[model samples]
Target: MTKNILFIMFDQLRFDYLSCAGHPHLHTPNIDRIAERGVRFTRAYVQSPVCGASRMSTYTGRYASTHGAQYNGFPLRVGEMTLGDHLRPLGMDCWLIGKTHMRVDAEGMERLGLSPDSVIGARQAECGFDVWCRDDGLWAEGPDGFYDENRSPYNEYLKSRGYPGENPWADFANAAVEGGDIASGWFMTNANKPANIAEEDSETPWLTGEAIKFIEQAKGPWCAHLSYIKPHWPYIVPAPYHDMFGPNHVPAAVRHDSERDNPHPVYAAFMNNRIGRAFSREEVRQKVIPAYMGLIKQCDDQMGRLFDFLERNGRMQDTMIVITSDHGDYLGDHWLGEKDLFHEPSVKVPLIIYEPSPDADATRGTTCDALVESIDLPATFIEVAGGKVPDHIVEGRSLLPFLHGKTPENWRDYAISEYDYSTSPMAAELDVAPRDARLFMVTDQRWKFIHAEGGFRPMLFDLVSDPNEFDDLGDSADHADIIALMYDRLGKWGRRMSQRVTVSDEQINAARTGGKQVGILIGVFEPDEVPPAASSKYRGPVPTKEKD
Candidate 1:
């Protein structure tokens, strides 16, 4: 009999939202159980924090550098190998049940049985999923079949219940000119909460039900890709869960009082922008985070149903249930919200692997602080399924070694990640004198660097000392060696990206351990940096932390 592997991902699920992660007030018991059963990775990262980009990297296991699907509008290239592709050929019956946000264009529309008219206000290609059940893009759909005009999700959801209005996202974006809700961050806050909690909401229950079904119908070695879009936005959960958490228990918002502090200007600008700026502690308490955690707990409660079904169907022992989020939600950790910033709160996500077998070590609740990524997930799954993960197809090495209790001595010194600053909405907001976009990053741990474009607006954070990521070592001559080394390493690593070179993990590791020195400042194991402004008082959890 083939093993049934359930790959579950929560949309915009932050790394620390899980109950097992020591979240004092979170409501995630089901996920907590999953952690208890298997391995929970502490420092798992996504390639890009944005949904489309992160999903693309996850689906393809290829870095954004080669994928070129750097942002939402950027389409994933055709003919790329995905987790689905690898499994399907092995007769795994891979099914994409919900939220395959892969931007299906006309050429790819037929497979999923979708048409141009199928989507109302958003562009949805039909063939994106093998068994699709999704609304318009990123919950940005209008009341397509439900109403007359384009309305906010709040309005469209209300329309399904006999209410109607313009799309809030659109409305809020245009509100400055329209003058309806000026300075009011209602769209992300109160307005969207009701729908989130409603059992009638299409996406949530649809996803949950399908997950239950997959657990029940597992006959053989099957792979079900269940993606949930909740805990992502609309900060709404149904009634009981909606009122699940009290405001007083929400964590405090963070602030950095360092003069040396200078983040990527993209984030700094958002901090100083009208709606942007580090959120206040009171804001994190009142209107900001409670709802986000509410949704987290909501996902937990729903996932509990899946767990119950697995045990009921007697499939618990034969299944390798993996739970992870595409990315992390920065719930005011550094004053950021749902993602795209190069802060720990945005990029890091909780990666919990639960393989229900008695033979699995009793001390299964282990956390690997070594930097890993979403791109490594597919290979690990393939390895666990006892299937052949083609050499060229898999990008990251298998976690089977770590999972199987083989503590390989001297794992790679670092896990490298790079993000091009020019791709975000925040970047266009600034029109610098000389138009130059610089590529930079934080290493396996700390010791950050930014290689400022004109060499004037630069940034560097000694993240070890300043976990807040506020201190900018950019202009300091004291850390000159670190700065120059980071820039040099950035050039080498950045060259592989911009230049498109495919080096094996062995080769990369060779460069790391074999002392075959290649590039600039190579980072060992450094701690992560905290983002700025994740929770806003007026906004739900959109701390307005802009990513570069």
Candidate 2:
């Protein structure tokens, strides 16, 4: 049995950036080590592309629609079970050492009378984890006040280290050293400058140290969700890392002139987005991508430190390690800045699972091309903990069978991803209603279908031929049949049984035997319709009644 889990999530890291995943310039050997020891899922996807909704789906093992956290800053409704809720009952302590990006459902908390200080309340507020240290990692302050309500512990640590500023989060941790002044790394032009903070004190390293501390203090079988907030935004890196990559390291943007010519309305709106327009320029890409690469490198280095620590401490043999990102960044691909689309750059993520078991040794260093999703991790963890996966609760299937070199029968054929852009500025620009602003992506190996609500036609991509997703095949007359088939699949996916929480499968199976006795056979008009074995039992059931 797996004694511990180190679930590592990198925010906004692209699937292809790592050298293990085939990036020509940028290398991520530390992350690649996890892949070398286990299975790397080449086609894993998340339910949503945005931070909050994506992580919510990951934690709850449910889709964004089922969890009701459809976008960033949206609350995961109270009473929804999460990974912590599932693992704790199996005697594993679920603890968080970094970001969750969870927005607590304060209204639901108030209505349900949950106090923030109580154990249950704390778990609800933090998405079911016992937080060792909670930091969403963004601490921007404006006239309206801080972007987040909670004060950043990293900011306090920066202030203590003699970094001077009203916002050390921006000035020291994210700013670059100039001759006499601080160059804010938030600016695209200043991306080449090294952040003033020491590399050891940067976000990635600091989180790693905290994770180590948590491991040292851990008493029993536990899972530490060590989420790192890097390669995400601010697009800057501290010393050494900042100087590591330059314009030469940046890859050419995967875009074409044909993508913009007669683009879909929603796609056009994304192109017009401020961040997308900024990233479209070659100069901007040259400046921004290098720092993004550097940040990823720093994260990899931290992983090296983390893994070495685990191994040196003898925890590696007993722990199962998972390395993945919540979702991929567009990096100006698909004419989009951030993730909010069905394109592979935005939705497809890297999923590597390393189980320290003899059974998993055969599949070591292998790649699994099967369709997988981020929500599947919860079930995988549950199984690794030697607990049965509650299928009715978790919508995803476990990868244990695959990890043991056994291919499951009737595995998923297509991957599903969703985006609710109603709260985004692009939705307003496109004049879409909040209720109607929804998009669902259903992708098989050869085809990708994007269905949008609010009077928009479906978008189709023949991934085998048009893998770059540059063509707007939504209007192609010849591919209408493929579009219809994909729609049928989406309908089937949408109609799956969800939220069967109150009733257990065992109870339902038991109820099956009560069919005729409870008058449930009312529709049986003919004796032949019933099975011969059950016909006599039901037919003579009303022969006598107990008179008391």
Candidate 3:
């Protein structure tokens, strides 16, 4: 039987929001079901804390710094090998049904004389996936124009269903009906109100239906990336989901007053930003967390629908279903509104993989605490599709060994996450040069160390003693040893050979001994110094020089 992959990703989903992850109130049975059938990675982290960079890492199986799509709107440069680029040759047809948040490297493409209309260029423009239905899901209209200028199928679908306005994605799906005017979900004040659209017509359900449609029509083994842009922003859900949870269900924000008393300069800047100050208010959390919970609940329901369709069609037995998120929402955690930090709430994401092969049965319902990164997904997909992971291009190790109930040799000791705040408002407030406005997080089992650029001292947290991460031991002389160790790890990761993609390690090793066979020998002092076979060609060519 042919093996397939169902790569499902949710935008801005937190690690602790699901019931399986020990959420006291928000239950996610559908997401939990996948965890029960396979291994749930408790220590999975994104390569970056923001959406575009994190998703780029997952698609390319490389670090954001390596791929050069450091932040949102930064293009995934041409020649960067992504999931489809690796898996297609192994007979797996990779397709995208939703958001990748991938921007094309227009300059790179133009330099190479590649047209976006061509097959290769089109695949490169869409993050290496053959586009099934592409939508980045941010249809917000600004004073200039819509945030995403791409033609929106979701908006068209809403209009076809009898919804009014040119952009129903914003008006109905993301706006709440007030007494006379529609309150935009862009404003946190409208978060408590129900979205004007029907639950079935909402983004999650619509994407889920599209995924089912793609699976029903696929002819052969394929990797369907069903990425949902939900539980993200415009934190308002339709009807039943909107009222399912209230402020009472919201957990206390994991923050301490001590964090504000003399925080790291970089942390202080983020805390004092407009979004952070707004979310820092108690009333804002009360209004937003319930709506956030509702969005996740709606997502879980859609997962059930998608899973049921797969099982009824016998796709479950052959398909490996992976459920995860791009990054996570801060949502008032640590006095932050969005995901642009190294906090656990902003960096850690839920990762569940349900592989139906009998080889995975031994590890069913088990939770692995291995330090997993988002880049590992593409590597895993390539390996599952019967392709060898090219270590020169793909920087992550495959998780198949862990799925088969065995630990891989030389497993990673640390997980890394990066954030480029060069274009952020926080950078402007801090008066930092674009090059210096960077942050990198290197976390192992016990220590989570954050190294900020611009000569700022590193932020250190003792996860063993202070898992909440309220204390900043960055200036403490006592933990300097641990800080030094983490710095060394970060330096080692930075010096990795990430750019030698044109050749593989195997090719390099073979080439070392291959030169002599082709009759090209360097540094041979004498005929006696080499074997007869190597010097035979030269021995016969020796001739006496003409007298001058």
Reference-based lDDT, residue 190, model 2: 88
Superposed by TM-score, candidate 3 places the C-alpha of residue 360 at a distance from the truth, in angstroms, of: 0.7
TM-score for each candidate, following the candidate numbering: 0.75, 0.93, 0.97
Question: What lDDT score belongs to each candidate, Candidate 1 first?
Answer: 0.61, 0.88, 0.92
Q: Write the residue-wise lDDT of candidate 2 on 1-548 in tens digits.
A: 54799999999989999999999988888889989999999999999988888999999999889888998888899999999999998999999988999999999999999999999999999999999998999887779988888878788777888877767888888888678787887787888888888888888998999999999989869989999888898888987988788777777789999998988888888888888898788888888888899999999999999999988999989999999998888887766677888789889998999989899999999999999999999999898877898888899889999999999889999988889999888889888999889999998988989988989888888888888988878989999899989989999999988888778797799877763343345578798886677666556546567789
Q: Tens digits of per-residue lDDT for model 1 on 1-548? A: 34678888888887766768987777578888888888888878787777777787777777776677666666665445677667666666566666656664445445555455653112333222345344332434444642222223333444555432444332331122223433322344452233422454444555677567655655567777788877776554555555667767676655555431555565665565433443433553366566677667767877887788888877778788888887776655555555656677777788888766554575487777776778888787676666765645555667666776665566544455545556544556665432454344545576656554634445677768987776667778898888777767766655653322345555677877755333223353332221122222223555677889
Question: 1 or 3, which is superior by lDDT?
Answer: 3
Q: Per the 3 Å backbone cut-off, how many clashing residue pairs does candidate 2 have? A: 0
- Model 2 spans > 4 angstroms off: 514-548
> Best lDDT goes to which candidate?
3
Question: In model 2, what is the error at residue 77, expressed in angstroms?
Answer: 0.5
Better of 1 and 2 by lDDT: 2
Candidates by lDDT, descending order: 3, 2, 1
Candidates arranged by TM-score, highest first: 3, 2, 1
Question: Candidate 3: where are CA atoms >4 Å away?
Answer: 525-548
Q: Per-residue alpha-carbon lDDT of model 3 for 348-411, expressed as tens digits? A: 9999999899999999999999999999998899889888899999999999999999999999
